[model samples]
Target: MDWQYENGRIYSTDENGELMCEATFIRKENGEMDIDHTYVNPVLRGQGVAAQMMEVVAEYFRKEQLKTTATCSYANIWLKRHEKLYPDILSEDTSDQAVACKIDGKH
Candidate 1:
């Protein structure tokens, strides 16, 4: 799927322009990128779309030479799972974000 980029986001939309996948990041004072939210439409779930989005985000970080931490639960988990592939971009500390996420008012 083709992705679109903005200042701190990468996302894709369906033909009708409905958001199909989205990942939003917050830029930290230290130039770290805190991936704060990631979403995949229900229709696209179970298709590895989320992982693909993460890869795109990771590649962006790699290219920009930015450090990454994730406050979004999914992003945090994904970063760890793919740590071996993105060690250079992964932040050394994410404990502060262990309980971070705004989905379903869970934050």
Candidate 2:
């Protein structure tokens, strides 16, 4: 499996070039980026695909010196579990308002 990053999104692809999972980050009004969406193909579930994608997203955020709001439920859970790995990028405000706006097309 290989991970590709492009257009502010990360994609996991198999050797055959089939997509296994994907995660996207959207820039918010406050200049922080949100991990707004993530999907792992049902066939690829439980294979650590989402965890790998989250790692890539976290690394990208650190390298770019950007903050992150984990809106995706999986991402939120991952962040909580890996707080030490991303302390600086984790926002102090954990309110779901930003995520809600993004989902409702209000942001």
Candidate 3:
């Protein structure tokens, strides 16, 4: 997937411009980023697309020398799963309660 980056989002769209996947974050007052949303189109689910998206997000943070926490459930879990590879990028306050999927309101 061809991901696109913006001020606070990393996402990809189909040829017709329909959203395929997305992860959104907000910059915190403490200078840490809080990942708040993640979405994958149904057609793209079960294909490891969400994991790929998180990898992109992780790489982006590493490249920018930023720290991050994840309020979005998937992101929170993913970060923990890959902590060894991104030790310095995860904030100490990285734990978050489970949240519904932002795009469809599914848990």
The residue-level lDDT of candidate 3 at 53 comes to 97
Per-model TM-score versus the true fold:
0.91, 0.81, 0.90
Per-residue CA lDDT of candidate 1, range 34-68, in tens? 99899999999999999999999999999999998
Runs off by more than 4 Å, candidate 3: 96-107
RMSD to true structure for each model, in Å? 1.8, 3.3, 2.4
Which ranges in model 1 have alpha carbons more than 4 Å from their true place? 104-106
Scored by TM-score, the top model is 1
**TM match of model 2 to true structure:** 0.81
- Worst lDDT 10-window in candidate 2: 97-106
Residue clash pairs of candidate 2: none
Candidate 3 lDDT by residue in tens digits, 1-107: 99999999999999999999999998999999988899899999999999999999999999999999887889988999999999989998875534445655333
Task: List candidate 2 stretches off by more than 4 Å.
Answer: 95-107
